[model samples]
Target: MARSTAMKAAGLILALLIFTFFSLAASSSNNQIQILNAERRIDLSSHIVKVFLTLKVENVGTSPASEIFLAFPPSQADQLALVKAQAAIGKKKKKSYVHLDVNPTQLPDAPNGTKYFSISLLNPLSSGETATLEVLYILTHSLEPFPTEISQLESQLVYFRDSALILSPYHIKQQTTFIKTPSTKVESFTRVEPTKFAGRELKYGPYEDRPPYSFSPVIVHLENNSPFAVVEELLREVEISHWGNLQITEHYKLVHAGARHKGVFSRVDYQSRASVKGASSFKHLLASLPPRVHSVYYRDEIGNISSSHLRTDYRKSELEIEPRYPLFGGWKATFVIGYGLPLEDFLFESPDGKRYLNFSFGCPLAQTVVNKLTIKVVLPEGSKDPSAAVPYPVEQHLETKYSYLDVVGRTVLVLEKKNVVPEHITPFQVYYTFKPIFMLAEPLMLASVYFLFFMACVAYLQIDISIRK
Candidate 1:
């Protein structure tokens, strides 16, 4: 009897949960939220979608509205990833920090693309009180191959699609989206009524407010021939030794994301096509180094690569590296490059008697996009009181590592950043102090060891105890 009662209780709880979920879903459909503006910018140069959505939401029906849910289509779930998201109260351009809860709940019965996300307002919206929120998110892989296949030398066309209306939990009042194409060679696109095209920009609509669950569709197709280089990871390291030198090294793992090459890569055909003015294949990366840096080295996972060139004596040094394989679409390559310079060039002693280092590092190649970047700075052992200032949105932390004859591990500053472009190669300032004793301790320790060894040898020889014994 007790078992039966427990089972009955469990069934009752499950029934209540199911009923509540359906009730909420029905209520959400009855009264919808409104979108005031939806502006989307597409950059083929970086293959990213930046969206700004201005929403006016309220609690019209009795209970307080704590949050709103948005979801992406199931078909698109595998192709895109969200890189950044934030929200602010009405027309707040400076962006208020809002943590988005992705895929908050799971419903087995829901449709295929039910990747639900939630946004919280600082305060609950009571009945009749409204709040406007500015929302922004970066979406990757916004384009897809229209033809699904292409020849090596032919241009590729990609297709893009978006909802005619912005997805919202509530009805939208007004919304518009302006899309800019990569090039002027647009082949086809959706022609919604009242749409306009000026140059490469396409404007969708200032459509009248839509009822709950209303629909519209926007699609576009455009031609592209540029080499799309996607760097999956970039690791940069800086070693600082007050003894006189600073070493910087960077490693890159990259993939070519342009149109797929239909056949095996041919050197003869490639060389002939590459000689043309504008070739789609990726050939080299250009790295910028300080002038007169003669200790630069470039290599891959293998021992050494000889296809690197260093041109110096100019305003700045440039390193041009040709990969072992000409990078075609869907191909991957990784390499490591490093250089050294005098520590005095970037070190300074402040009036407060503190030592500081201003260091910067970046890619040696041009027209490259880094998806993730992490830089580690290894300071000399026995250095103390560490602090750093990095010029990007990053997570900064410290690690410890030990090298030859080190009594204690050295302090390493680790700075990790995302979506790094070429311009992000800016300077970071690291501050630390070295005591007089610590500076002189290593040499003194070495001299004392040598002296003691010499004395022991002389003492053993002078005793000559072996002759008598």
Candidate 2:
């Protein structure tokens, strides 16, 4: 027992030594890097909040720096939807942008449970070397409705909260924050110092010599009447047929995510005074679709809706649709959109003789957020070894779907994701193995049914063993 206790004590000592070493290393690395200049522009022109950040960073220490960390409070981190970064190369006049990899990471010594995402540089910055990075991040459901409830005639107002300084682990020399609202009708804003308000734009800072993790919270209240379309649930089904066609159907349960509507709605006032009445309500939405789409249809629970138009070109198709009624704050609608496409465009054969279908994921509607999204790819009967290749992380599983003339049912690959945004609308591929002979199953079944029906008719007409005879 004594020997075991001594061994355990020794292990604890070693672990403590290792932790101390790593902590010191991280501290040293943080001290080595600094931001020369930083600029942030917050665009609050719509329901969605978009932030653009530009940072000029340099390695002031004697070591190389390969990654930079972005700091965000826990509240904002939950609302973050998309983050993309690019690095500038060459001179200013003739420069190109290269994409950088940004991924969430955990650090043990983070203060106040701050979340961090590390942006990896293509090439490490040596001592005294500098690099410029441009980052664009999108946040959804970030704006808070001021009153939380409003009348139809009342215009919408929201509150946006953010930091005046750029949140970074490294020290910053100079930084500035600019905020642009939808209209010049600003209600109120929290001024940090050295702040300027001109028209619809608010400028904050040019703060200099900020230490690491410096933050100053600011809130802005402004007028914004843009539609806040949020899809509570969306299910997209893609059925592949080897007979030269691909079918896609999408079901949506949509809601207005802004302030709730109060009192009774006046249709007469809304129709006559359209310019001022129900300014916060929306009735029109647009969807972008692929080229050569056929048999496109849109409908709601009440049946086919005629208030829709489709424009097609060689490049792409645009679909404009309006709900049966204008969607006010807290209003809800359910609908479906379906279309068919040429199979040759989306289906392809691999070198290994496997078949795959390339299709777009996420809701087709523009500037909308989906709380829950489910994509189902139904493969033909007799398909085997089904798999999915999505660019991002998603919950994937297999299911069976029985269709017309299906004996063993079609194999379905289901991919589920939450908090889906417009940025999630990317191409995803579903791969499976299918034998050509399976194509004849439905045809043979139909032929057999027709032959049996003919034989029964012939016997009924020609045979003499009937009860009536």
Candidate 3:
């Protein structure tokens, strides 16, 4: 039979080339798993703030890979559900993934795969698999120390992570040196590892898996008279204008995280160290302004900043700013602030009517040597089909006819980012597409140049005598 139909068409082309090489090795092993590594640690002496995610799966199939899923974006799952509900109410117990809410179809029942509870994996992950997951959270008003400290004036404290506070009975006792026996060499509470509180609360450690760049070297000589301000760095900008206005800018760089005063700084030993109330070298910083912002300014870079102090409320529109030297302990400062508002309080009018604008700003985490930072956004003269996006890497430029008078110059959007930290200031966004004939080409080119100079002064009064001369 003609050689068995040519050997059954060569065995159906070798079984379609072995099913296209196992479908490209199962799509390159699901694109080599992913995530690889992620970290966020803020311990500050057991106040607790840890987020570490590392994943990598590569099997190259032969048969042996089970399951894998990792996805967290809703503001990093609400900062890991407020650090697992402040470490389960400071460990009174009741931690079922502590108030879980990590969306995305709740990722196939997370347990060891942690999809954020609501039906964890009973068990089953065997193949050519590779796994590793670790999640620990605890936030509850991180730490504080502003009960009392006078020395040279300046004190204030309040930093929350998984917060709680209620201290008031005085008789303080938590020192290390400066005379107070029972020595353990005060290596800062022997590198922390204590918990359980009440009567002015004091708890530390639910201690599970402790190993993400471990830290323990404490220091708390309370009765802090106040003043150890540490801003490190801060830059804020909110710009939006569709003619209705809304601009608020702030730039600050401050330091003085305390502890280190050997010599040189003795105004009569700081006026007798502020009369023995002791523990002072200045630190007072505060900010809270938002109410249809108005013309409020504070400058630096060699200008304005006469030790700053402003309080406003032009009828229910509040503002309170205070700053002008008093941030001692390795002192350093920088400033800039501005305000103006009314862009319909951050534009939004859709339903097919188009027009949207949103903004957020504030970043300063111990001055991480910012190499560069630039942001220039001006839209609404004739906003084209623009869609600006920046989560870090950006470079775009386009220009045409730009001139100002009644205005015709608009559509300038420039964004540049580098090094950036401080949690990337709320995912920047800028989109456009507003063209009303570029606002009538600058008022019709200034009324056609004043009607061609009034027809050249009525044709120069009917020119004639000029030739006879």
Which candidate leads the pack in TM-score?
2
| Model 3: lDDT to the true structure | 0.43
lDDT of candidate 2 over 1-469, digit per residue (tens):
9999999999999999988888787788788999999999999988878899999999999989899888888879889887889999998789999999999887667889899888999998999999999999989899999889999999999999888887788899999999999999999999889999998899999999999989888889888899999999999999999999999999999999999999999999999886589999999999999999999999998899999999999999999999999999999999999999999999998899999998888888998998899999999999999988898779999999999899999999999998888888899889899999999999999999999999999989997885884
Which is the better candidate, 2 or 3, if ranked by lDDT?
A: 2
User: What C-alpha root-mean-square deviation, in Å, does candidate 3 show against the real structure?
Assistant: 18.8
Query: Is 1 or 2 the stronger prediction by lDDT?
Result: 2
In candidate 2, list every pair of residues with a backbone clash: none
Q: How well is each residue in 1-469 modelled by candidate 3, as lDDT tens digits?
A: 9999989988998887877776565344334433222223333332122333222333334554443333332323433322211111222364333332222334322223322322122233244443333333432222343332222343333233221110101111121111121112122222244443233323444343332113333333322223444444444455555667877676766655444343355556555654342244543444545455667777788777654454556443333344564444456777787777788866665566556665543242221223334455556566676565564445666543353563545665656554343344554556676655665776688898999898988888787766565
| Residue 418, candidate 1: C-alpha displacement in angstroms | 4.9
The lDDT leader among the candidates is 2
| Structural similarity to truth (TM-score) of each candidate | 0.65, 0.95, 0.35
Give stretches of model 1 more than 4 Å off: 1-40, 46-139, 146-151, 163-176, 196-199, 206-217, 275-279, 289-294, 309-317, 342-357, 360-367, 385-397, 417-433, 452-469
lDDT of 1 by residue, 39-131 (tens): 445455445555556565656667676666665566555434443344454444864556443334443334545555566655776777776
lDDT accuracy of residue 460 in candidate 1: 90
Query: Measured by TM-score, how close is model 2 to the native structure?
Result: 0.95
Better of 1 and 2 by TM-score: 2
RMSD to truth, every model = 6.8, 1.9, 18.8
In candidate 2 the C-alpha lDDT for residue 460 amounts to 92
